[model samples]
Target: MKHNFGAGPCILPKEVFQEASQAVLDFNNTGLSILEISHRSKEFEEVVVETERLVRELLNVPQNYSVLFLQGGASQQFAMVPLNLLPEGGKAAYFDTGVWATKAAKEAKKIGQVEIVASSSDKNYNYIPKGFEIPADSAYFHYTSNNTIYGTEVFEKPTTSVPTVVDMSSDILSRVIDITDYDLIYAGAQKNMGPAGVTLVIIKDEILGRSGRSLPSILDYEPHIKAGSMYNTPPVYSIYVSMLNLRWLKAKGGISVIEQENIVKARTLYDEIERNPFFKGTAAVEDRSRMNVTFVMENSDLEAEFLALSKERNLIGIKGHRSVGGFRASIYNALSITSINALVDAMREFEEKHK
Candidate 1:
């Protein structure tokens, strides 16, 4: 069995990849590859339409909300979000969690005043910052739902009187969430969706039109939403594969079922880490992520041997971010229970041998 633990452009359901590969070669038996199909064609339109429908159906998004599949990863949305929502000189509340959150805040700074309502940097981002007040006059309150590089997560989102915009790049569909809780949610498709190249944006109707700035055709959200994510030539293959993934998720009883599975998977690995003598977890227990399980050995001496053994066992991408040195096993949506179990087993086996 092969287990992939890479962070982005990570593992997808083998079935989804297989079906997508077929489409790339011969879409709908139309004798055309998805890559070459015109975005205006009915074939591609169906793909976009189905993707939108599946997104709303899977997440129970309200009618007033619009979903757009666009180019530029979540990073671009970071800038677009502040530009679209912030009034002239208006401010926004930002929570600094990790790399992505910092990027979002940095972009927001360019548009208007930014208040660091909360931050976890003091603790090296091993814990979530809590108990910050959102400025009532702020245009929107933005936070990163999960910190991918640091293995930290804000499980219970902070409440704000203003509109809430979330960068859900790493943990968008990993669980069930009420769409009404946020005005805008942006997720890069690479992590839990399909591939890199596209970003998913869900925006509420009310919060738009505040920017007032003249946005380039590509930077504006309304244009893409109006064109049904086909405003310009889209990444058809990525969106098509994401549709298949959403379909796979719907078949498995939607987000509720997967949320439970994610909990079990995370707990199984975290429990082993907590119990093992040579292992120590990095993220605070209360703020640990359900998708990325990060930990470190008692000493760094055995790192080479551990990685080599894991690779030998067909496990991949267990290395942590360079900024935070340790082991990070990314248990994304496509990662199976059996795979997590194998990682746990390997940990135990390694501990027994090393101890």
Candidate 2:
């Protein structure tokens, strides 16, 4: 069996893949493939509705929020959030933890004035900044909940009086979050939720028309909300697969159960990284992420050899990103504790070989 740890467009449950594969040929016994069905069809419409319902149920989202399945990934949300929430000439506050957070702030800058409340650039984003003051008068405060590249996460929402928005692409469903605390939360579905092509946005309804600037219908939240996420042809197959994945999540006892498993999986790996003399974790202990665990060998020369051994052991996509060139084991919802064990076993084997 192969263990997959790719960051995005990453692994989904085996059952989800099996079901999605069948749908590609025949969805729900319909003659047409899921890909071929009209977005307006009753069957496809049911899929979209169930997908939204599952999101709300799993997250305990309130009725006042709109759950949208959008086209562009979280990158588009970087623009849309500001376009909808940040009015012309208004200022927004952002916290920069990594590349995605930096990009979010950069996009907001194009729309209006943006203040970077704090940043971890001094430490290469290995940690989350603290004690930063968010301007109470800012239109909104934005931050990325999890930094995939740096393997850091802000588990606690910062105290801010202004409206709060989070880019949760990598960690949206990995744990429990209070929906009432934030005015908006957006995530690219590729990581914990499902496949690529669909981005999830949960926005408090009152914030929809606050920007005041006229937006293209497609870019505007009102049209999509009014149309029930069918402003145009949606990503049908992606939403279908996402629905299946969400079903899997619900069947597995929801977020609270999966969260405990994730905690155990992350700790099991991080514990080995600490106990093993040959390797060391990269992120600060307090800021380490439960979804992506990053670490490196003490002696860099043996890096390539261990990578080869990992491949030999059927470990795939464990290589780290270019920015932080070590190893990033993306332990998303679909990756099992068994896979984490496989990785820990590999680490132990590498240590024995080195010793």
Candidate 3:
């Protein structure tokens, strides 16, 4: 079996895939494919409810918070957040760490003023900036918790009193986080939660309608919350599969258990990268992500050959993003430690050949 390490549309538990695939033919004995069923039907509604409950329970989300499964991914959220939070002419503070963070600030600028507190772009986003200042008068502060392309992550929520929003698209649910730490959190479901079509949003209820700008019903979070994520036809299949994956995660002892595994997986791979003479990591040691591990070779010319060998060994998606131009191994919740080992072994093989 090939090890999958692609950035998004992530790997899911085998059991989740089996159950999701079965639902495509027949969902929970409804005699109807999940795709064919009316989203308003009780069966699908139960799926949404359970999915939300699982999310709340796993994250220990506060009762005052609203959990929603919506469409258009975190990219959509980039606009929705500023539209719903930043009032007319108000400024928002944003911390820029990578591409998504920059894009988020850019979108917010189109809606209102944005103050970039700090940026790591000077070093091609290889590290997280420190000692940044968020304006106390700003409407809210926003940041991307994880940078997938650069393989850097912000583990601790930056110290700020203002309302905080985080785009945790790539690293949500992989580790344990206190739900009350932020005013709003949005993650694209494709990375660790489920699939591409749905985006999971957890928002503090009081933050709604703060913008005072009349928004399109679909673009507004209030309407979606009022409709119970059924404002329009939701991403039925994506939500259902996410529910299944959540169930699998729960059965595997939830986020805490998976987090330990993730730590070990990341350490194993990083250990190989450090031990191998030919390899070197790109991200700062302190900010290196536990989800996506980015590394490069001492001799950049050997990248193509190493990628070819990785494929021969049944490894997939180890190639890094064009911007980074190195190998990025994305180790999501469902990716087994075994897969990490396979990649490490391949690195050793390359070292043997070169040494």
Cα lDDT of all candidates, in order? Answer: 0.89, 0.94, 0.94
- Regions of model 2 farther than 4 Å from truth: none
**lDDT per residue (tens digit) for residues 1-355 in model 3:** 9899989887898898899999999999999999999998999999999999999999999999999999998999999999999999899999999989999999999999999999999999999998778889999999999999999999988899999999999999999999889999999999899988999999999988789999998999999999999999999999999999999999999999999999999999999889999999999999999999999999999999999999999988999999999799999999999999999989988888888
Could you give candidate 1's per-residue lDDT for residues 50-107 as a string of tens digits? 9999999989999999999988898899889988888778888898998889999999
Alpha-carbon runs more than 4 Å astray in model 3: none
Question: RMSD to native for every prediction?
Answer: 0.9, 0.6, 0.7
lDDT of 2 by residue, 1-355 (tens): 9999999899999999999999999999998889888899999999999999999999999999999999889899999999999988899999999999999999889899999999999988999988889999999999999999999999999999999999999999999989999999999999999999999999999977888998999999999999999999999999999999999999999999999999999999999999999899999999999988888889988999999999999999999988888899999999999999999999999889879
Pairs clashing in candidate 1? none
Q: 113 in model 1: Cα distance from truth in Å?
A: 1.2
TM-score of each predicted structure versus truth: 0.98, 0.99, 0.99
